[model samples]
Target: MATLNRRRFLALSGLSAMGAWLGTASVLAAERDAAGLLPRNLWTSPRFASSPFTVGVASGDPTPDGAVLWTRLAPQPLEFGSGMPPRPLLVHWEVAADPQMRQVVQHGASLAHPELGHAVHVELAGLLPARPYWYRFSVADHHSAVGMTRTLPAADAPVDLLRFAVAGCQHYEEGHFTAWRHIAEEPLDFVFHYGDYIYEGASQPGVRSMNGRPFTNLRNHVGEQTYTLDDYRRRYAQYKTDPDLQAAHAAAPWFVTFDDHEVDNNWAGAQDQDGTPSEVFLLRRAQAFQAYYENMPLRRSALPRNGHMQLYRRARFGRLMDLHVLDTRQYRSRQVPIADRTQVESPARSIVGAGQEQWLFDGLADRAPRWHTIAHQVSLGNYAREKDGVIVSSDDQWSGYLDSRRRLLEHIQRTGQGNVVTACGDAHRHYASDLVQDNRDSGIISSEFLATSITSGADGQGEDEFARNTLRHSPHLRAVTDKRGYVLCEVTDKHWIGDMKILDQVMQPGGTLSRWRRYAVEHGRPGLQEA
Candidate 1:
């Protein structure tokens, strides 16, 4: 059955698009009236005790014309209200052709309202396509770090080379974000963050390590699980303070989506894991969605409306690939235990519901790009294992909803849609598997490259027993690992290749990293073969 998330939220908002950010540009527009009078409560010459740009700058949701430039002015990064005054600040931004901002191309002013966490989202438009640009934010005497961003090629343009990285599941207290530093150094067009960006559970007590060595939280931070708007905002503020994460955001634009941890563990639609009433749970969800939009570089279109936020959208990288970012948590049926085999394939169960399923099917029918990268959040293959002498699949993954999985696969097989590649996370482990129907005999219809994590498992041991056994028993499964790293993807007109970048350790700084495995799928092929 479908969820009551959107319907209930829409009733509460009495509007759509959140209405908080949609009027931002208009407010800025009204700054100069007919008499050239400055707006009221606009902070122009305000000064801070210290630099407020400690969280750094970022850009995302790029288009051929422009992208969204993001930054929050927070001198006290850990405090509520961001420790800023209860007024709007007139922030100035610039886009230039050089790192030093010598050749200025675009410039504008935006209001960083206190109601919106004192964050600025400048959705720039009317720029040339397929080119690099540098941006920075300024207020009074303080300036944010110069971040590099680029516009994508036109949707109809042909592409020869496309490079990006898939990464997610970054638990802050578990370990350091060393891998983000590595990602910041890579020459990539963009990065796809498939979620678990923040862990919602409270931190552990103390002294959990091995080998007579002590592995402590990088910051030794202590906090409760996030529930209110301030809680989520504080959590994000803490995460954004990481220099490595800021570097990655400053390096390239990112396409991001949330998973269970962004709200609560294993949350499905209107239902929570604890069986809390949907009415009460949706209030917390509304707060979480609001917090997410404030911290990320999302467009005004993605603003939260009550409890719902529109995150399922697509972008085309020339004619090479079309990225369909999915929101698998907001509208789906409640998950049952793995033992409920009788309900696994029932028509009543839907992971994406009907509306999103149709949207996905229609996107697959498009004949434009050579590849369709379906960005997902959970294991989508048959991750079944022996349970009480019976094979049971995961309730949180696609295998638990066989009818939904079968419909997606059967659509691909029916339409002969080739060169489909999926990037999924939330498993905290790397998996390279072939996408087949619920019945394994239907053959491989697509390929999945599961990005492991940034530091979730705290220096995970490579090649776990599950990998060895699953690789042996499951023919559709190609490779598996427990390394704490991301996946690097390089696509050409003829083929697509993914390299699983492995980190030897993440509990300590300066851990060594390398490419441990490589897989390739040809332009028109469906299965992933080791390269």
Candidate 2:
């Protein structure tokens, strides 16, 4: 499949591959036509008070020979409709082999429609494999900040090292995205954002206490809760406007997936936690999905259809690792209360749905790789807490889907699939544990590293009371810390190493950071060993 490009990947994926390919072809064709009509330096239309690249530029979902370049034309980002006219605008983009913008490899024009908030998603192909490229977009005299992106190595290439950062849960109101600032400076190939890019809620001022501590909200989301497409789009703009978050996006290519906060909190399938009817909830979901697709650096294959988006896909890092990005919230059953342990283990419950579950299992069973990294949203290992001497579990995570979790673990055990690691988000705390079927000391099948939130917890104390409770209760939990930060990981042929980078504070700007801990797993091992 050396000749395979982004278009052909869509063609070989699933039953909808043909339709997806045609849609991608149409987008590329439009880009080609616009490029033919207008030169990169021309087309100066005075349509804005300032430059339209307010949210900055990003690139994601890279292939061996291709990558998706993204930018939204939002001069007045917080305003409705992002301060753009109700018409389509043609934007020019270019990919260069160097940072100086010389030796241009691919350049084209993509029409940015107002319906999608004038966002440009250029699906570039036919470039050199396993290499870095500089990209930028231009509209008239407005030039976007240049972003760096890289394509994956050939599937059979012998890779020496792969470095990346895992991060998620950036609640806009709680604190600043200082962790993202630190991530922007890291020397890494890519960043895996495991969801919760934005929070959909009515903002409140002042302090809110959690774990017996007073935490303040320095910023807030504007307007009412996000339900309509315009609301969601504006919400995304609010988060994307942060300079730190934009720097992280501009730094490297990212692999992203959504958790609950991208839509409504604790939403399951078509059911909302606030008891909105399925039909109504699905309508809101459709709007949210459309806005998410518009603002994100994603390929057209992830375009929303009605209320659903096919976000579960794979990114290969040569023969070193195959990162399987999973979507758990979209197809989950309604969440049970944490106290209801019996019902939580019901056989009918599923978090990743049947089709996605099968797809992941089949991918793991296909062949042996040095690492099988499951880019999941929530914790896979059980994190039970001791409350009044009684152990209780969170219904929001894999603990609530015992049967489903068992199936995946069983597959690993049965296939002897070692070197399996789950890079997870949510829960707002850093956790590392072993995925064991029964006792913590017995039948250890895999390892999981749950990254803490980027800024969701607001100047959090280290290893707060809740984490202490969890560490005391769950023997499988190796480490737990309450901090605002991201996780850095480096993969070699023999050892997979990870470091938890914690920020000193996020309530204000220019916070300090430190590496909290480092862990490693050997190529033939399934459990984590402290480095």
Candidate 3:
């Protein structure tokens, strides 16, 4: 085989990301060994006394040609700055056709910079699409766990089936991540963790009562609510050390975006729940955004700069489905009181900002895919909870931004768009519902499947008064469960099926996993039906 020249090599690998630190635009091609990794002499490698790949490996933002490979070089992840020296280190990575990595396909070297918390995001762009590939990262003597990732099918190609999972809300102090273990074992094409990946609060202090039963926190956070870049980095490092979460990331490529808790609970735009000043909060928001990009399997395109990250992008699975991931918290207006019907119905309100709202409106009407799906944070339905014996609406959900919700739904109806299914988090409880215009009996428009948390809210005791009240009053709601788990969706040309995978407990290891609810939507049909 002919050796790859500088232009061909640059086109195949993402070595340019490290150009600032490495002081070079191209690397001379070096002879490879049977293992597909480069020879030690050709690359500058740092020898870590202890393994720095403590957070494991992950891949995400897959295009037709390639995906982003992510890992943070952290040996002591719990301490400040991940206990790493402030310096740049060369890291080698490779991809292979076989799991054993004997059939090496492409390989290259990149630098992990301390400015980005020693994180490496290798963005490869020349590989076969619609097929599975194995990848890993290495330093001088340490190698990360092998992760499996696949590219989406070519845009014009037809796909027969697509399987993926939706999961999020993993508060470290809540409970164990047993659900992630099961997710790792599932045969999935990709995973969407919609938000609240890390709870910003400090350690939980004592026992609490739920349903008159005494329970204590199963774990604890390291510090107070994350505010600084180091604090956010430490929080992410602690969460990434979980074996179950690591396994899930290695299982398949993922699509990740943050909700409010990544910065502060119930935060929207520049305002926080505690009424912190906008300028003060933007500093924290920027820090949190940087830490989020550093830890997750995300591309540099989503990198944080000046407190902003472009996270609302689109991906696809051939012509079978269009994957539209939305960012709801970053650009939303201040949340209004649910009791204030007048404020909730205001036309100026928005949960997905104006730009993202327009993008969603335009894409939903596109005729390329048979199925159109939206994965985001927060619920998107008219749900109400009981307050003072009166059924009051929820301000944390779309019900709070009634006019905004109406505009999107009306667009879907007007454009004659169908097969619109939304997978969302932040509710903590799992909900399967058929969305309608203002809960009208004849206003069937789309289907919504809300994923429960991985460990947040601990092992909940079934439905509570709030959930019961919401379900009873919300005419479109079909099912609600407080179990800790995720949603598994399988789609084809003619049908879309979502399974509500549940767990009995998360306070202890080896929680039992089961499934009782399955929501189905037929081709050309919009609303969901119990299947």
Candidate 4:
């Protein structure tokens, strides 16, 4: 396998012709007008039809010579419940060493079935590893925008850098994905989506779309409103339609995990507190898990069976980075009561379950990479009461499971693990913290970076005060921002930098993004600091 820098890779691939081949801004505007997918016609014909390609194209699970490519086709647009004919379309994929693809490396075909809502995932193999690659998809006469992807380095290879993005909690009804658009413009090897990819439950009545229309439900509400395969699939399809999300997906490969929104808000392992029977919730979970698998570019082994999903996995980027993706939603105890939030601190209350805990510990113990990253959903750091009067434990967070969090942090501290940085989502706000093991005590420590929502919350206005107050109350917290955006990370052998990119407003289609803050973790420092 060979490695090349961005300039050489682009020069070799002929990406300079992207504007001409992919379509010019003017031409896309014409296409958008002809297609009518955007409101008020930002541009006619936009590059791809105004379809859900919004979640974009992404590749993940990169191996030495192969990677998994993903994209969901939205030919029917966003008119939910209008059962469009399930067309079995032939989708073509191509990977190139150069942007021009003059140096085509791999090419293949995948079936985009309407039954699966045209979501197509192709796992391409036999390519060079530790190298950069460009890819694109074509269905019928329509061609997807070009995307960037990379393969992991050889298991024992000495790696110099590993760049990636981390984000989650995108509520379509909350705001636009301008932040995603900005992220798409940056260079990234892959992305880690830490759950809340879509809010499976109904949108709150007062929520409004970018166009001021009341938020629409992707599915017609029914029953206790969950545990159905169709319901999950429809929700995913609806989310897949966002153009900004599509652009982000098209920009790089992604590693993902689910939090509460992927199923129901605050849903713990096999536990539904909404008066639903345990059996019914479990069945619904199975359906949701299966639907999630079908939509994601996941390997067959990770697929769900008998209503259970295995989300814990590992991905290595040469010797530069080792990402331990955790399944916090599965194999965990239920949320504790607000009053007894501190009382629920029991080791028996597992977030990743016993098996997953072992897996994570083992991965960390190996210490094979320059950087160790935990792509887990939700905050791992403590978020206790900010003031005496405020009620703090939102059982869904690590705050409720203090014992479990301590055990994991203690493991990292005891092992003397270096660069053990955690990437998380769920709080709907961007945060940077020095994950001290004994946050209440001074001797123990670790580091974590929590990303803001892609669109969830009211334009990034969810519980921001609580987060700010929590940060102020806890010295371990480095920074906090209640903004709608994502986190961009640039990892190298010597250091890892996390950039919080914030959008002005998500309620509109296109907004500006400004850097809120930046933090850095040195090669051997298990903590974060101002960059």
RMSD of each: 5.4, 5.7, 5.5, 10.7
TM-score of 4: 0.81
What's the C-alpha lDDT at position 165 in model 4? 83
Lowest summed lDDT window (length 10), candidate 2: 11-20
Error of 1 at 167 (Å): 0.3
Residue 487 error, candidate 3, Å? 0.7
Candidate 2 lDDT, tens digit per residue, 1-531? 124244532432221222223453455445447543222332246466789999999999999988888999998899998888766556777788999899777776666756567887888777778999998988877899999999999887888999999999999998889999899999889999999999999887787786577766688789899989889999999999999999999999999999998899989899999998899889999998888899889998898865689999998888888899999999999998867767787779999999999999988875646788899999999888888888898888999888888888888777775778889989888898988874224467888889999988787889877888898888888998989899999999888888988988888888899988888888777778999
Predicted candidate 3 versus true structure: per-residue lDDT over 1-531, tens digit per residue: 224343433332345333323433245232122223332323254667899899999999999998988889999999997867776666878789999999977777775766678888888777898999999988877999999999999999999999999999998888899999999999999999999999898875898775467878887788877889999999999899999999999999999989988888899998898888899988888888888888888876687767899999899788999989999988888988787888888888888888999999888889888889988888887776667898887787888898889888888878775778888988888999988888344478888999999988889877777678778888789888788999999999988999999998899899999995998999778878777
TM-score of 3: 0.92
- CA lDDT for candidate 1: 0.83
- Runs of candidate 1 exceeding 4 Å displacement: 1-31, 34-39, 208-218
In the predicted model 1, the residue pairs found to clash are none
Q: How are the candidates ranked when ordered by TM-score, highest leading?
A: 3, 1, 2, 4
List the global CA lDDT of all models: 0.83, 0.84, 0.84, 0.70
The local lDDT score (0 to 100) that residue 327 gets in candidate 2 is 96
Q: Candidate 3: lDDT over CA atoms?
A: 0.84
For residues 71-141, write the lDDT of model 4, one tens digit per residue. 77665544442233443444567788887767776665554544445666666667777788988876545
